[model samples]
Target: MRTVYSEDHRLHDGKHELLEGQFMKVHESPSRADIVIGRVRSAGLGEIIAPQEFGLEPILKVHDEGLVRFLENAWDDWAATGRTFDALPHVWPVPGLSRGALGRRLSDCIDGKLGYYAIDAGTPIMSGTWAAVRASANVALTAQKLVATGEKSAFALCRPPGHHAGSDFYGGYCFLNNAGIAAQAFRDQGARRIAILDVDYHHGNGTQQMFYERGDVLTISLHADPEQEFPYFIGYADEIGAGAGEGYHMNLPLPWGTDWQGYSAALDRAMKRIEQYGAEALIVSLGLDTFEHDPISRFKLAEADYQRLGQRIAWADLPTLFVMEGGYAVEALGVNTVNVLMGFEQR
Candidate 1:
């Protein structure tokens, strides 16, 4: 499998994020990609290439213009206020607030804009955030192009992992919704239908929201139950898409301590669904955070289990593009992530 990577991902490195009532070192660090790429090299996973600059046109397909513009200028806007620290949102326009025309006026301030477009405070904006996020999206697009052409599979080693971002909001350490962008790219490149299988420990709330009302792309995620995990609002079995997308989206919310036995069952069901849907291509939101020792996630998938996970995904028998997502167990990240690719190749 060819792997698409970008050094620009290091540019968006953040210092701290608000978590557990206090600001602490961010878990979504630059080293996450560094470690994963290192493993890919050591394991002889295949060629590692730089991403082609697809520009903002491909990104605008799934992200909102306002959100994109905000990310591009957020750091400078915040810096103008005389603060050099990482920018985190302090407030949000919650349920009762006016999200209409007046809300647009409220976002005139940098702080208000941060709150206006962010879902949580964990994702911090730094000076290089825009560059890094743009590069990350390009990484995903390059890999998608590879599969769309002729490659059997490709890995988009994206950073600031994008499964948590929505069309107009950014959070969960994500900014551009890389997988959603790639899935949309597949659609734009003439694929009649695409399936995105999210194996991240956390639900792909952003990806779900992007494709929830569309039937062309089938999004299936197997993650920790939202009630017991982050992004506690959606990702339930009940959210099986809407309108034209009805019966196309599926959420397999597992429990916190779920092991391979439980996870594999869900994977089996997801594969069956993909087969039934007759997708032309597949995109795996590959997140290694489901590992047993991940710091910020809960799941009992062991290192060796990742190979099995990969094999099962390969069984789906569709052209696949694996877009990197969450995984905070820094030391073991590479091995676990490559295990999936290696397994796919072996299959």
Candidate 2:
């Protein structure tokens, strides 16, 4: 598989993020991509290339205009407040806080706007965030274009993992939904239907919301039950899309200690649905956080399991785009991620 990456991913490095209740070092770091890319080269996976600029039009396809503008100027708006640390939202409109009262263009109210636009406190905005965010989207888009135009498959080594970002909100160390953007790009490029399979340890709530009401893009995720994981909403099996997308969405929530035996059944079920959908292409929200050693995530997947996972995905025989998402076991990330890619190639 051809890999698309960018060095600009190093720019959005936030010093800390709120995990659980305490502030901790950001698990989603530039080094995650560094390790993955280094392994790709060392293992002779395939050619590595810089991302080509696709501009904002492709991003706007799956994101809100106001949200895009907020991400663009968020740093400057926060810096104007005279504090110089990473900008994080201190409040949120959760459960029942009268969210309808918030205005759309609150550029003058940075804090309020920050809360309105941000879904969680884990993602922070630094001086170079927007540049890196834009570049990351471009990275996913470039690799997506390669597959959409006829390559068998490609890898989008996106940083600041995106499966947790929604159309108008950013969090879970994600600013934009890279996998969502790529699926939208395929739609804009004329493919009638596409399926996104998220194998991340956490539910891809953002990607699910992006396509929850649209049938053209089918989204499926396998992750720890929301009752026990972060982003504790909307990953249940009951949220099977809405309106035209009624039957297109699926979620297979598993227990915390799940290993290969329990996980493979879900993968088989997900692949069966993708087969039923007959999508023209597939997007795998490739996240290796299910590794046994992941710091924050729970699951018992071993290194060898990733190869089987990739082999199962390859069995579908559709053009695929592997958009990087989350994986926090830094040392083992490269081996597990590359294991999936290598397995796909060998399969």
Specify the highest-TM-score model's number. Answer: 1
Error of 2 at 182 (Å): 0.8
**TM per prediction:** 0.98, 0.97
Question: Which regions in candidate 1 have their CA more than 4 angstroms from the true location?
Answer: 99-106
Error of 2 at 200 (Å): 0.5
- Model 1 scores a TM of 0.98
**Candidate 2 lDDT tens digits, 1-347:** 89999999999899998988999888888899999999999999899999999899988988999899999988998899897999999976665664354433343578887888888888989999999999999999999999988999999999878999999888888989999999998998899999999999999999999999999999999999999997897799999999999999999999999999999999999999999999999999999999999999889999999999999999999999999999999999999998998888874
In terms of lDDT, model 1 sits at 0.93
User: Per-residue lDDT tens digits of candidate 1, residues 225-321?
Assistant: 9999889999999999999999999999999899999999999999999999999999999999999999988799999999999998899889999
Candidate 2 residues lying further than 4 Å off, grouped into runs, are 99-107
Displacement of residue 242 (Cα, Å) in model 2 is 0.4
